[model samples]
Target: MTTRVRDDTWVWALAGLALGLFGLGFVVRWQCTRGACALGRHEWLFDLDAVGSLPRLFTTSLFLAATVVAVRVAARSAGRRRLWWAAIAVVGVGLVFAKLVSAHSVVEGLDGRGLTLLVGTVATVVGLPVLARLGRAWGVPGARAVVLSLAVYAVAALGLDQVTGLAAGLDPSPLPDAAATFVEELGEALAALGVLAVVVRRLPHPAER
Candidate 1:
């Protein structure tokens, strides 16, 4: 028999981690009025600011709770079709979070930068499941491709911002703060992908059971 674990467990854990880290960012924002100086002074607080409150924190929390239930229900569905739904939910929420944290000054309206972000968001929504499916079939290289794609997106977004003079980035060397935000979002996405990879690696395939 295949060893099947609860999908809700994984979903809830991911949601909780996301919420905690997002909440911590909000805390850090509050504490660091003078840019990152306060944060540097209270470096220990980094533990707390790991994930500051996610955008529309209350709504996101409710959605996450619902996600837990959805994953549980999907796990028991006829063909596990709910997996696609769960994947979409994860990607959609991730895109929303990215939109929220990204520097908007570069792409405030429905212009060039905004269009680029929209296209990237759509690509992410489509790419995640494809990446997952590929990972299961091709292993590490497939996962690496997904990560590299994300990094590329980050770089492209920063480049667009620079060309259009949208926002500042955090890169000390050359990129502005807005570009830095894109890199940061990319980092978070990579981290999320890592967690998903671990979960997929541990869970037994449906046929194995």
Candidate 2:
């Protein structure tokens, strides 16, 4: 009972820390945008849209941590289960790189809309069944939460971003551009943290198999 309580506490604490960092990043962004600081001097650090910004670094850290945990989980498993964990680790590494490099902007420059559609279709057609199998094989604490967080991350990083771009191109968007960026970035960090929290919770002790 005590162990379970401690595990829950750790998850909540990590979640809170992730939210706190996100809020601080947003505040800095808001201040910089409103002329409180020299925009050119601080934009690289505070701008949510900037590559390698604080928020970007934070998101990357979360993904990297999740990837490490996935690798650890893979090391302890075998057969199809090991393959699933290995795939997740690979995706997590890709996410870390994407966050650091602002890969989405590069994609947008090269027929991003069509590419996103193609990728989304393939993911849905292939990913769902694989996920179903993984869920059965995963059998770890917080597996559902990890899966759900990944879904949320995909929606925010992909779907919401495309909508934001489309709205900006077509008309006045209901969401301010900065606000949309904030939500998207925050959602991504939160989702990554969510996955990390679950994996950390489920990670076996060093003494365990």
Candidate 3:
């Protein structure tokens, strides 16, 4: 396919919408627990709200946005094929992962070995296919490189979380810490990759290959 380069208004719009929805989610979560549930008032608006934190919001938004971008990029780089199913898988699994991991602090009266196992299983089943679909969209040639870049991003996010934790003295325990770290890192990575993919495609390819 001949690569095309131009500013896709939809891409920017999608990014803005994703970020806005994320901020909205935070407000909703804050209001829900504080007002409706009567969980006692806490500073969430500016205090990074324990509801999910910046990392979670950033990562999740990136993930969703990346999925949409991936479908489009796949169509351009590969071919114009319906990648909605892949989008669904990626988005669905991500939601499940967030829900499962968030249960500990976000939900009450729900903590057991079996339950964690079940949630993990569901997330795995869903996430695997989602990743696989993303790979397909990326195509065999570039899939490994994309995934590797994403992995590196995830690790960097973890490092960032650690730094943030040290400065803020947030929860140090492994489970919650790791979960939040993963969410943020993965999300940022996906969004970044989506941008990079578009930029790279737009650039003129070398004549040799």
lDDT of the candidates, in the order given: 0.45, 0.70, 0.46
lDDT of 1 by residue, 10-90 (tens): 556655665565455544543453355455745434422123334234333433443453354346433434454355347
Each model's Cα RMSD: 12.8, 3.5, 9.1
TM-score sort, best first: 2, 3, 1
Q: Identify the superior model by TM-score, candidate 1 or candidate 3.
A: 3
Cα lDDT, model 1, residue 36? 50
- The window of 10 residues in a row where model 1 has the poorest summed lDDT is 47-56
Residue 113 Cα positional deviation in candidate 3, in Å, after optimal superposition: 18
Residue-level lDDT tens digits of model 3 in 89-170: 3543454355325543333236533454455456545654566566676454444445444445434433454454454356
So what's the TM-score on candidate 1?
0.32
Ranking by lDDT: 2, 3, 1
Colliding residue pairs in candidate 3: 59-187
- Each model's TM-score? 0.32, 0.78, 0.39
Residue range 72-168, candidate 2, lDDT tens digits = 9878866776777777788788888878887777766788666865675476458745675676766644456666667767766676677667656
